[model samples]
Target chain A: MASPARGNHVWVGSETGILKGINLQKKQATNYKFGDAVLSRHEAVTTMCWGDPYESEIYVGCLDGSVKLFSTEKGKFTESRDCREGEGPFCGLAVLDGSLITCVQSGLLKVWRDTSSENVEIQVGPGVCRMCQNPEQLHRVATGGKENCLKVWDLHQPQEPIFRAKNVRNDWLDLRVPIWDRDMQFLPGSEKIVTCTGYHQVRLYDPSSPQRRPVLEATFGEYPLTALSLTPDANAVVVGSSRGDVAVIDLRQGRLVKCLKGFAGSVRAIQCHPALPLVASCGLDRFLRVHNLHQKRLEHKVYLKSRLNCLLLTSREKWENEDSPAELQSDVKEEEDDEIWNSMEVVATKRKAETQPCCESGNKEPRKDKPSRKKKIRKAES
Target chain B: MAEKLGKGRTSQKAQHNAEKAEAVASPGEGQGAPVQPDQVLFPPSFSVSEIKNKQRRHFMFLRWKQQQRKEKLAIKKKRKKEREALGDKAPPKPVPKTIENQRVYDETTVDPNDEEVALDEATDEFAPYFNRQTVPKILITTSDRPRGKTVRFCEQLSKCIPNSHVYYRRGLALKRIIPQCMSRDFTDLIVINEDRKIPNGLVLSHLPDGPTAHFRMSSVRLRKEIKRKGKAPTEHQPEVILNNFTTRLGHSIGRMFASLFPHDPQFVGRQVATFHNQRDYIFFRFHRYIFKNEKKVAIQELGPRFTLKLRSLQKGTFDSKFGEYEWIHKRHEMDTSRRKFHL
Candidate 1:
């Protein structure tokens, strides 16, 4: 019987428009290139979403407004489609109920179907920085940005936002507060939405509440917060700033739990493992680092040599029973061959030295050398 | 007896051979000059003044004197070159004057016998207006002509001010923009006018009041100068320095200016912005940081430093004529006059 693949693989999107799959167990990375010259050099992979719950197909959004679907099994791009003209360089992508949903920076959210020419389009707002889908309620998505505060939209309704964030009242100085939400995520099992802003603020908005403003507001470093991810337990969120500072903020207390160091560039994407207490992050620094949440130690680090924009972690259960027995057997045979070859080199050198001086007495020397060659014969047999 | 004699002869011969080998191996050691008894012995103590006199006449002292003379000659040559460059127009000497002895005319220090005082008295009849608030609430806006660069410039300026906001003109008339500003309660308004896709004019107006200043901005460039040499490291954080600000008020003003530009995104690990003020002109220097380590920071100029100058100042609200440009003429006129102004 074959042993299962021991660890999960991380999929990353690079700035050169390449999709990379890194196997943590083998420390091997495989680059999947698009066929037919589809992706240009300047077309960076901006956003990515899995097509199905099984994650067999991945939808990758590019900077040139093209969305390519890649097959995880075949390790190649299966199809490509262009969004409406002047619509993309998508900020977010999601596959819900077999339909493709793409949100552009200009706040055009479009839902496309495979067989129909008709598409549902909604204008969220201009300067939309991020659009995130609620994992619990797949039909609901949130969008926010510069002038466009936070708004949760329902695909079923498609007309207006379900929850629109009202701008906070005038500050203590009676000045209107500016709104700039850079990234947001939905808290699991709740109607609350957590958003990080360019103003260096992390705010949590509960739509179920009567109030329209954020219920909890916390400030981080002076720089803008670029990306954030909820922990598996949903009690805390890991926020990364443009200054490369990453910290876990407690949701209940609105206090910082701990800061994870070692980032030198703006962190682009961060995600925590669903099954294990591990958080994997990638950024402009071109490194994918997996950190243990409990131990606070880096578990694995791989340099992809390209600025990474997005990453997805494969399900850990699928890792089990994934490695084939035939490959493992071949690997063992190759190691044995290497060992035999190394020993053969030493035996050949010894034989040459003995044969050079005994050329005249070669026949007698061969009979005498037979006794001294026992070790070489035994090594070859093994 | 004969056996013992033979062994003794052989040992003596071996010793002589060893001695001969040592002599041949190190001839310089054997031929070294003999040391004098006085040289090996410590010298008698001398007085400190006597030692100093002897040292002053030594070759080391002469070498020091020569180096000093060379430096003095170089300094003299540089001064002579500067003087030659200046020609006949040397900087005027500063005249020392005491506050009590200084004569005042039209609330300005002037010579008692000056003939221009009568003419200046007519200008001093108007009272000065002051906006007392220290912290500024600014609204940054671009001209009706909207371009990508202008919008980006407006966005950068908005980020520089903590309480400021960016609003694109989007072909909206000033009549419509004013009401929106009033509703939003913006204390000040800044409009950047672009000509041929280049920012050439800036209009600063106090909201709900008059007196707008127009400035001419020249030499606008974006990230055109920043060049990425190698792979940007993971830990690079851009450093921001606002230089040449003096007191606490100046520090606050410097901070307000620094807040106009967005936090360095640090995409290439070396983006830096330096705002340096000399006299009334502010020079903006944007560059890429080159750091070998924490202690070594190298600045590679990314683009040409931009210089801003005040072109014109209107007395009252942007287009309306009401107050005189006394604030521009004398910055401390309001503080000294103790007059109240309505906004």
Candidate 2:
């Protein structure tokens, strides 16, 4: 179990309470069941997150209000604790500096520390759908749900929200627009928060701005969007809808970029690689699919034999191919050379002479030579 | 072909020489060509429809069909004789290709001995029904203002399953009806939707908790429409036969159909309910059987048969707007291959 779990690229939580580890390089899947009891939906994993930056440990939150800690090194569950503060299944799970943060559907958010007396419990609001931590600022976490607007709380303060999003204006009919933020992510380099709502809208909120409402809003397909993840470049987001439509939406232009196909059910979770152009998604279709973001092509599809609830993609680089690191190093060296060339100045006449044909011939030479060269080669062969 | 068209639109004398010249030169031109050797044996292009005289064309077509049949029979006879002569040394016969036999490989096909699938089935929504913990009490309703044919179809379906009740929809929302059904101890809710006086959709939702299945219902035949159907079904429980439900999704669907009936079947009634799935279409049939002799059995079809194609399977009860779908039939994406089947 330790050997198989070591190189796994993705970890998917299924509705059957089985934690599946998939090694994309080997095309092998290993299932880790916690106990000897009968497999039941009561213990189905509702949410999962890495316990630390190294991703060696996993925190699995189940529907039965138990949070089990799994160590990838040992390939076994190390600890299990009942987070019984909430009334419903866990909506989200996160780890901040070795402490565990869990939020349930009943709006109970609890922070568990090494000492029981230091535990902090906060009620964000009722009907909370998701609670996610800001990666850049470890202490900041956001919570939103049905009828619950986006609220970013500073865990250090715990008294008031640092940033609270106001609801968008009413529709043309003068009725209040609904609020159902199914999933959200914090942009890496900025204070902007991107969220996908159950009403099929993708909204970007800038906490640093004076306005409390979302600055940019874009709607995708008709069905409610269930999950979303930002691309590695952080310029676009991949959103999945309840009707199995997954598309990349450009955050800057608020435009649809490209749609990834071959999904047959509602997408429950999507996690994009932090560096690679790949996105892994799993849903009720019972298949985990990895799509290449650049090519927009499905790369791998594995049938895990149960409805999937959540997904976690490894942030490790060079997992797809071992030889990629050498190529990436050469690319970095070439970029450095290009920077040196750009820094040097040249005489005005020589620069004009060097740049004119380079620009004109670069575009014209290929068109003029390609067909004629092919014809000459054909004639010589004949 | 050109001559035949010209012969209809204008006088026969007009373009008669050109038509004759072309038709006479066409076959000669084919024979003269070096690229097409088969053109010598057959004309370049000729169809019976191009023949001007309808009577003569019909006669020629019939004779051609008969000749083809004769050739096929001759090949069969020759093969059989060769096989008989070399009975001990004949090679194995080649299997014919069929859509089912050449079906695309489905990774989700359940292996009976697989422990995970068995465990999954054991704890699914149908576990109580399969474990005999909950008695099967079905409430069959129709879309509001159901027509006579759909109405009669539901009535006939109720007769086939024991402990099933047919209820009028009475213009109530299914969401509202679900809570009322749960309080009354209903184990299943089946709603038949009709369009243009014909039943076109069927929604089967498991009660209390659900994995609701929506199916496109077609080719519905009532009792009076069936030719030589048996009498109205008896009240005793009938044995259920589910065929070709091989995949994981198919297993769930098969279990849903199986749970609609009681646990113990009454053999004395000799009644059977079969849900036969082929190429993703489920055919429902009720029959009564009797063994006449050791090797011979007679079966009579009961009333009301229909075909169902699964449209979607939702995780919860009757919330299309917000409910998550387990599997959905996307015609453009999923139906790209003819030999591919979901159930």
Ten contiguous residues with the weakest lDDT in model 2 chain B = B24-33
Specify the poorest-scoring 10-residue window by lDDT in model 2 chain A.
Answer: A322-331
Predicted model 2 interface RMSD:
0.9
Q: What is the TM-score of each candidate against the true structure?
A: 0.47, 0.86
Residues B1-343, model 1: lDDT tens digits: 9686565445334433433554322111212433232443222232123335575536444553454466468668867787788988966645887432252222122333543222222222111112222334578888886687777777655543445788767887765676677677665678888888878777767556534556667766554433543232233333567765542223323444543333444556556667775543457765566678989987666433455555434434554221223122223322243231100
Q: Count clashing residue pairs in model 2.
A: 0
lDDT of 1 at A307: 61
Query: Which residue pairs show collisions in model 2?
Result: none
> lDDT tens digits, residues B1-343, model 2?
8675454324222223323544421222212333322322333355455679999877766765564466468669979999999998999999999999999999999998988778888999999988879999999999999998999999999999899999999999999999999999999999999999999999999988888999999999998898988887888889999999999999999999998999989999999999999999999999999999999999999868999999999888889888888888889988998999999
Chain A TM-score values, per prediction? 0.82, 0.83
Query: How well docked is model 1, in DockQ terms?
Result: 0.02
